[model samples]
Target: MTAGAIAAEPLGVACPMDLGWRYASGAAMERFLAGLRERRIEALRCDGCGRRYLPPRPLCGDCRLPLDRWVPVAAAGTLEAWSVYRLPILDGRTGEPRPTPYGIGLVRLDGADTTINHLLAETDPGRLRIGLRVRAVWREELRGALDDILHFEVAR
Candidate 1:
């Protein structure tokens, strides 16, 4: 086939995307992710709203106020709500969404005012429920990111 003909031919194409993001000058984010690496959770408190934010940020989303206070939260928390997803979507780190039958849960930490969205290790449909107490399972090494904690599991 000529160059023009080849270009016109029906060819399956897949365009990959980079989902990862690097926060420019994110001192607060650095600390937050570092805490997770150490199996510790951290949050930033908004001086104005008095709301503690998990995955600490320099600014409060609600009031758009600058947050400078740092608070350490517990690794253990309660499951505020959850749902089992059967459809695969893009994983945060990997561009490809993982296989189905995974549990995505909203976790309210012991000291935070908001819930964080994370993966749940236990996927038993019967065992999963609202108000379920869960705890963070940290990785063997500290990587300074949310992935440091592999997933939350039903607290024994």
Candidate 2:
């Protein structure tokens, strides 16, 4: 076939996939997870810009500097942004569908410059708002993962 003819031909392919994989969370994340098991919230502070990062990263995105300073962050924070989902969605950790009328929020935890996305206990749109004070509700059993926090609820 000529080069022009080959380029003109449509190409298509489809296949089923069942993939499994494993990855190392790295030293920074490992420490972060470990702290979660102890009910401690820690963040990495950038020396150059003084920006604190939750889930402790190895380097600062803005200053491009190494972030090794660990600081305590409060489990309570301000809800910066939020949404209410009325459709059932699969929970990646459990591989099950979460019921409809759920709430999710981007929370700026105290002492951290960044926000973390997590489930919100308040599903009613009328009660949820930006700058609302929220606190983490922990699971009965402690685990070294973000899921250790069941969800955030409006602080009384």
| Tens digit of per-residue lDDT, candidate 1, span 1-156 | 457634565778797665657567478887777676667777888888889897677688889988889887888889999988888777676566789898889999998989989999888888998888999888888778787878899997
Q: Using TM-score as the measure, which candidate wins?
A: 2
Model 1 lDDT, residue 137, Cα: 82
Worst 10 residues of 2 by lDDT: 1-10
Clashes of 1: 1
TM-score for all models, in order of appearance: 0.80, 0.85
Predicted structure 2, TM vs. truth: 0.85
Q: List model 2 lDDT by residue over 1-156, tens digit each.
A: 557634556777887455667978999999998988988999999999998998687899888999999999999999999999898877765678978888999999998989999999998999999999999999889989999999999999
